[model samples]
Target chain A: MSNNNALAARVRGTVHVIGAGLLGASVGLGLRERGVDVTLEDQSPTTVALAADYGAGRLRTAQDPEPALVVVATPPDVTADVIERALTTYPNAVVTDVASVKLAPYLELLRRGLDLKNYVGSHPMAGRERGGAIMARADLFVARPWVICRDHETPAEALALVEDVALDLGATPLEMTPEEHDRSVGLVSHLPQVVSSLLAARLIPASEQAVGLAGAGLRDTTRIASSDPELWVQILGANRAPVVELLDAFGKDLASFADALRDPEQTGAKRRIADLLSSGNRGVARIPGKHGSSERFTSIMVLIDDTPGQLGRLLTELGELGINMEDLRLEHSPGAQIGFAEIAVLPEVAERAVTDLVERGWRTL
Target chain B: MSNNNALAARVRGTVHVIGAGLLGASVGLGLRERGVDVTLEDQSPTTVALAADYGAGRLRTAQDPEPALVVVATPPDVTADVIERALTTYPNAVVTDVASVKLAPYLELLRRGLDLKNYVGSHPMAGRERGGAIMARADLFVARPWVICRDHETPAEALALVEDVALDLGATPLEMTPEEHDRSVGLVSHLPQVVSSLLAARLIPASEQAVGLAGAGLRDTTRIASSDPELWVQILGANRAPVVELLDAFGKDLASFADALRDPEQTGAKRRIADLLSSGNRGVARIPGKHGSSERFTSIMVLIDDTPGQLGRLLTELGELGINMEDLRLEHSPGAQIGFAEIAVLPEVAERAVTDLVERGWRTL
Candidate 1:
């Protein structure tokens, strides 16, 4: 108890958190679990105090020594100001902000001509549908990508400290330039967000019967449309350059596809449409699923009858066979006692699993 | 065994299947299971023979009586010709073709001045990534929507015959006019397919690093992009009018959204973006999940340690608690022994589940 814990030893002195919202509070809780002393500050005293009560950290005071590191987890619009203030106030401490966009704030700081050697910009690819200090959890950042932006002039020690924090929170730290980070996120995160929002927005004017006919396709495409708009506006605004470019490019693709589909007889129209759709097939195949090497997972269709008893027994037998079911999707007809379950498992065991199930008198597709 | 099965009682006389492909072979397989006399026909003799050997149906013989009902399950482009051939040959039989696009083929048959009373247009909204006789399942249509178009002049018995076939195959039969069906499918299915394909096509030029950062959102939005291009061309071509209109409307939505995102300083620009996103929220809320009433499902996030034992024990306790998990999403960082498992359950039990989990020494978000 007298000695410093593993993380506390390297993270000397108090690690001050300047914003006690979801990201800030989560960072405090995660670090505190590693036995580091965390000091909390927020614009709203009640919010900061609530975070403290929840074991995030206690409020900082004048008597406390200058912190070794300060984490600015404020909203994206105010990130540059917060970082500047932290650097000005704590002259000796390292400063970092968990802003989604890395370039805007970095450029703003550069424009101010402040000595920003201590500042490191980072963004954690993790969030929930709702945002608040109450929604924060110690394990929130675990297994997520935490992108760390570094400059050529930055000292190696400052970069290491931020990476250490990310690792301590159980996140994989990826290093990228601010430009690369913004562009990459614009493609993977911001672009998808805008597209999903637009797709779901189309549903507003649809008839109940039309919406009722919606299957997994529409649902999956629009799931992220539930994200808070105000928060997105801030993120998208900060990364407007890359996001606008991506949206424009995506729009052109949409236009060409529609044109081809509109007049399929206009020489090469059908081929053009097929070529674009085939590109989509190749593009989708590149994404990594939950297991990382997602291509390794294969789905086997198993026939099922209306009797509920068979489902229970099938699950039991899968477990008995030592098959770790990756995912399961069931198709059951309403008022009809027939359907099939599409089960996903590792490919190495897929054939064997099918054979074993068939030997036990199960039908597969 | 000598007597007709439950379904065969209503579906009297021989049922003839045309095309002997995924949909047609599946129809035969399902009807044969009910002891209905089913005969197979296809342009390709080898294909028909393969389907027959698979026990879908036997080849129609010269001595056999005319089929009571004929099902045409050809490609959308050839659907009209096949339906015409079936109607011309089986003059007295009730004829229905399972084509994805209803209006175009229906109009084509009407142009030929064929007898209007005996033909019903239907579509089964069920398919696999790949289509063939081998991929056909007896329960392929189970629990899915089967849209049937009927005109005022059609006989009730002809409509009932088509509906009965859908029911026997474990599908829910829905009645809609050709225009309504075409427009509804354009909104629910075709529009999303084009959007998803175009969104993913943009990824073909994306950097490997950017693609590597892809998450569940990107994957979900692009999943359907892997669909067969040839099949989509035929479906889109057959339903071009409605689909083109939808795509054009969706393009306008994208343009306005991009303009708002591009010029945030413009009056109401930010508000416009927010409103669109908020509309998306409302739109997504209306989609039904696997259980039909998707709103009933609430996800509970549970914190898990790096230890493998904790997961096993968690599953055991969940079973012990009699909590039926609707879905599970695990967020685990590679090389980091910490993550959270998001467990979805019915909302009625969510509170009890959290309480029980906490009492059992499990931490939940």
Candidate 2:
């Protein structure tokens, strides 16, 4: 452990985590790994016990002392209520919640006339498609953005405590107001979820032959539609306004595109279509690559048979060639004995890599 | 070359390909590998010369006899005109165009009062994000769907020639009418492209922080939106009717979903949202998995430090354990020194695999 990660020494006493779900258990597990005294709880005794059994934390008891900090990691629907209760129950404890949406819970607490001085609403922009204690890992939060929402009335110590915890869990601390966090997630997370789900839903009515014509494009666009719907409902409802606005804007773009295509004979109609498509290129360009940079890499596809050692051998050969693969994707066609390993490398090396591979009796595309 | 692949013997004479783009060059290379005499042409002399130098095919000579088969592999916008020219130039030849959208080009030929008895429309459902001769590979169409459009007036010999070419290139030929082919691709390919593009375009105006919050979901959904916009514009415009209808229907779904979430407390509103999401689940399940089977696999995430030999070691260990990975996806957190390798294995071996991995000092999440 790094010296900077001695967060356990900073906290005066125990850290109690309410709700032993994925985020809560992950927080507990990460903090406990850093030698923090962590206690876990949940509405269901089984969940808390299961989280404890997984080395997330020990279960709280009547004999235990009051916690110095309380983390409420519950489902979004009950986040406000839980945070309200946590602040009241742990009078001196700094309380924070890891709900995906920020504005709703903060506004809810304000509406309830709760003094929010001790509470710092935060969201750790980290999760797996599947959730629960069983899926929790100590490194889940590592390097992910942990957005802390603090008002002017919020105590410096409380914000520092939350930031320290975020850092201790190996997360990058980002400060954003509740509204900013909600809108940001509304664009990035919630909007994409709805679009993906709706795109996949269209396939429900399509013919089997039509669906069978599905390629990598359709598969990619609908991949996230497989996420849990119950969790999404709560999230979407929490961040309704921003997501709705985004949907409206996106719907207009779709409609306008359809109009442009509907009458290509109109002057500039074709250009409009090209413009919309190009806009997509520009928009996707903004997304950071794996290294958090927008710089692109050239992909070289190498064909391999569907055998155990083929990919390993190819990668081993690539290593021998002194080619640093920036990214790797394996694509297998339906009912094919062949697979394609699409390796992304710096553009400058792509030509040489392809030539070398082809010369070495490997087929590349 | 396999003796059974007597493509040279079957062709009787040269096969001419009119576009030195990815698909056309790939077809040329695959056929060339099978010992078929192939002639290449393109709008750009340099493109054709480069494709020839790459061994895709040789340049046609003035004294060369008429091609036995002429494949019109032009851009989507000019596919029909090129197909007509190919048919007129080689009257006895079996003419085929490998354009993406079938019905549009087919209809255009009919409207021009040209006899298309020798012409067959086909689409090899294969491409890379980046196109051109440089990106071409011989195995591009291997096991990929190559749709052939045939009508009652179509001769058996002409259809057989096209099917043979598809087979010779290791593609699976599926016969469908022009209308059916257009509609199928409209749903499976065109609709998803539009949706993905629109979703991605929404990100163009988003804050940098919002884009930073993008995860695998956004990445997956927008993956194909990075495709060549110029090529897509021609495709979307050609298949305008069916795609418009799809977008309209999808728009209604999005509108209803937004409305449901907007007033989720209303009777059956929440149920409506849940039903839509569940439909997406069922729809995605209908997509054939790798190797044409819908067999699901259990994925286990293993955490590893981002270092050389870590992934190779994991795969090597997996081989030692006699575990066949169905699929593998690597995810790295931004600025983190650790990564997660999500390995998909058959459900039966998942439990044992996890246990054995943990015992071997590997962290399985």
Candidate 3:
């Protein structure tokens, strides 16, 4: 590995990581780990020091010279401005950014007359609910999709450099236009956040007893609502137009659903409920499977006794059959005699596992 | 514990669990575990057998006599009918029900001319995504709230028996009216499910490239969308009125938000985003603190390098501080220098932990 490092000797020029927040610091740390000479700069002295202490990069003082690559990992509001600054500050370097929403920044860069030849716009679709340089992770990008938005004006060399960085971090690089990226994320990312926040907002006035009764469903839906308000303010604000359009469409569907529920006729109500429920079914079908594409799995229902070792025993039996379980659900009735355990497994092995359990005096349903 | 078992024997009697599914079976198993004589009956013979095989209770044939307490653990659609049947078939037993939605079944019981004196409507707010008797757990009700809805006509003996059953299962018992319970759940439970399903539905048509970019946030928000459609149809249908009302309110708020975002004025757009984001702030505040009531906790931002042992080391340090982390977040930024680790802890310990980390070689922000 050291010989491989020697073969890929550091380019004489330094790599400048702008903003020095979570994304910026992560990029610096990841590149430094790969034997790149990285210099970090941030608007906040405290953030710069924090990133430096974590070995993200050496702190770049104001007098530091130009670099080969400049990664701008600032907020959406300032990504374009920082990118433009990097382009001017290091005329020989390639400039890139890690921002959630891409179109606006890309447009702003073009309007500002920065050399689009040296710039590439990208978004690494990975993040936690937290923020700042303190949470930088070298492997945060691994196995995640890193979207690169390339326009007709984007230079091939610059795009390749960005893709190389993405691959180095163990991410899959996907190419999309800025417009497509925005609209796509509007449905998959921003819209969900807005919807989650809206639902969570409803609980603000809920009674203590009501809130206490909250179960996993509510927890899962509102998990993103616990995100940093200030950061979301910027993200949603920047992507407001696309998100609003999606929410508007969603509101129409919700209205239709509400009206159907309010109808006195049972047929229409049941039909509407089924339709809405079926929509969810189709949506679940579209989500990528464990390894990145959708594939159907067989579901098996087993009767499990309410005992400590019962579940362990069931899992052990299935494991012995070498049946890889995809998903498992344990349903509990409040005062029922028994519960049903629904397990999802490979279709080929599901029947064998079921037959095995049944043969062992275990009830299979 | 053996002495406790002797004390429990003093109160043992024939416990009739009406529904033989997961909750009902679990109740039977719990009671049976405590040496209580449990007689389980279900509308369907298959379910009854499954519950019996899972040890919910000994299947009670038609010739069996009525038990002391009857637990109606059927689905909401048939809960009232089952309650009525149990009352008519075993007139001597004190009857209670375990339904997710309470008001409709309770009202239906009233309409069917059942003896309200012998019946107490109860809901144990616990369940898995799947259903059936095979998944029952003897401790499913442990430490969770078992709500008993009572009216002026309800017999004190019936309420006492229900409370006894709940206590025997180590559940906390709370009292409420059917109306209050329904509305409370509308805000905290049903509405969130609809919202999650609706959001998940939006992802059906998302581009494969975009879907590939999905992170943990999308996963969390849509986790509940995978719930059984047939069961949700019954749940949403039974509680249609309250759920529709809440959805209508949410739609209105969402519409207002959409209009705000579409406004051409920058200031107005930003103000709207701020409103939506701030709503989340208040919403998160209303959620109960981890394992307790609603209380604010301090969130510490820790800088984490994307390395194998980095997270483990941070957790170890926190454990050494005797600080129990309430929540955690990992923010992933593509092509960034570092990831952010947001750790939620008790407010009193936040400052000390931050200082301790800073004093050690770690950065705290």
Candidate 4:
């Protein structure tokens, strides 16, 4: 490997990645791009070979030296075992695992009476709906949060090594305790997953006519319910406590909301409904904007044809018009020939942007 | 008004709109554009004048001939009252309404023992998130579903007149009983709205760190929770029974899902969770596509900078390459300088489209 990246010099030896799935392979691909030597392994030889062919990393060989860092990127169910194995095999190396749930595996390692001073539990908050080596991307972690769970007993060098890998892969490293990581994800990820699934599940028994009335709102609300259930089963099981608490609290809220609407003639029923909905508005507003703060941008919708280069041209014209696009979203119906390009820009430029586009024979909505 | 549309000719005289809000103004604009005689009215003089200035229609005058049709486009709370008044004021003209809830008004009028032969309950399932005349578009109802509810005593001419206006406004007319319309909307629209609002409301008490970890799933699921709570309260109250029933059933489903996750070690617990989630997939799949069927498409993600014209150029190139896009969605992270344009294409052509895009220096994921 070419020794080009100063960041990779922190690790003196090869970095071995186990599992070779989407997350593992992506880590390998990213590290390799930085001119770091990476070795790949998986339970399935075919999977490892596929990752290798995809340039994620070369397969681990006997001739390879003991890696300075070992990354375990297996499924949640097997994460603890693999982390234990990696630590036992590479006593000289600092070990880390990129598992979504943090507390379970960490507890499991502790329960096994293993010395885990060198093992750091980390998770890159990045993934697509699907998984596997073939779907791995070197830039998957770019600008995304990568959480590192460390103990008080862990050495500073060990923590620095894991964080270096994260930075080298273009991920923003965040230090959190295992408990904190579990609780946060339980609220942000697992709770939403279960709620969305339950919401969509109600549709299963709906009449076709009812489903026919489904619009963009329903589509957006239930979009994530289509995620792989088997994978979710393992995730939810591993992170059961926080998710269960979230679900219980959410269920209480759902019950109260329904009760208020059911007998709206009751005193304060309407007020309750309005207060809850308004709280939703405030809650959603608190989510960090695409650039991470609470800043708001105005969006202008431009109509475009589905034919190629049309959107490109519109975007190009906006460029020529000196409009800086803060964000851009293309929306098309399932079978409509026309699509909408919703471009976000500074609020001050919104009126002028629409006028300029309209003057240029572009339809702005 | 000049005679141009044969559908407008079905009503030989002027069409009077009883409100100047978004739907009322849109109906007026659409009818006026098609050379139909349109007269507008509103409790708010300023609102009526604004709609008129936008070319929706002129204000009604004492000297004007009796309208051929009266459209009650008032708020849901006032719909029944306005419909009753319109029926009494113009005994010869057929009366129809464009309120979202149908049965509530129909029953209210029936309970008053008013003659119902000329009354038609209609709803145009088209609206922007925001309301008022400024958001009204002449083509707002184009390709959207417009439902008409008729009673046993409703004259054929009354039904035809309502259907004609729906057709003239470029909507597909769907005939249903008031009960059916209420039930259908309860399942598809009302249920989802309440569920989403409640889900988002849970976030109000969540820690900032949890909200910071939110992804597209959380965003998508709660996007509509920002809707006007005042309007939703009226709609839900007017259609209380169906919505209440739907919400109750949905609440039960959420509880069961949580229970299953809480005890996955029990017999069939994991399987039950999987089944419910998988059912969500089947349910979402059952939703009619934009063109009115359930068809699936493949999506390709292309990376673009937040710069000008880059997206337009890529789209133009896709058109040049003869790749027909089925749907397009743009995704970006807050604080990230880059965005992703996800384009949908036919499954058969997806591979070639990706290849062609990559060859043209576009990154496809």
Candidate DockQ scores, in order? 0.53, 0.68, 0.29, 0.68
The lDDT ranking, best first, is 2, 4, 1, 3
DockQ of candidate 3 against the true complex: 0.29
Q: In model 3, what is the error at residue B257, expressed in angstroms?
A: 1.4
Candidate 1 has an fnat equal to 0.54
Candidate 4 deviant stretches above 4 angstroms: A1-4, A305-309, A330-339, B1-3
Residue-wise lDDT of candidate 2 within B187-266, one digit each (tens)?
A: 88999888888888888888887788887778888888888998898898889999888888888888888888777788
Identify the candidate with maximal lDDT: 2
User: What is the per-residue lDDT of model 4 for residues A1-365, given as tens digits with 9 covering 90 to 100?
Assistant: 34346767888889999999889999999998988899999999999999999999998889898999999999899999999998898898999999899999999999999999989999988846357998898888877788999999989999999999897787888899999999988887888788778778878877776676677788888888889988888899999999888888888887787889888889999998888878887767777778888677897878776666777688778888988887666554434466577788989999999999999998776
TM-score of each: 0.93, 0.97, 0.84, 0.97
Better of 1 and 4 by DockQ: 4
List model 1 lDDT by residue over B244-283, tens digit each: 8998888898889889989999999999988988888887
- Runs with alpha carbons beyond 4 Å of true place in candidate 3: A2-12, A59-65, A264-267, A295-365, B1-12, B264-269, B295-365
Q: What is the TM-score of chain A in candidate 1?
A: 0.90
For candidate 3, write residues A1-365 as lDDT tens digits.
67326413534467788888888888888878888778988899999999999899997777777787788988778888888888887888888888888888887777877678888888887655346777787766766688898988777877887887887776779999988888888887888888888888888878888887776577768878877777777777677678878988899888887888788485677787777877876786776654566776777767665543455466656655566555555543323335556676778887788888788877665
What is the C-alpha lDDT profile of model 3 across B229-298, one tens digit per residue?
7888888888988999999999988987787777737567667767777787688667765455666668
Instruction: Name the 10 consecutive residues with the lowest summed lDDT in model 2 chain A.
Output: A1-10
List model 4 lDDT by residue over B161-257, tens digit each.
8998897787778888999999988887888788778778877787777777777888888878878888888898899999888878877887787
Per-residue accuracy of model 2 over A210-300 as CA lDDT, tens digit each:
7767787887788888889888888888998888888888888888888888888889989988988888898888887777777788998
Query: Cα lDDT for residue B24, model 1?
Result: 90
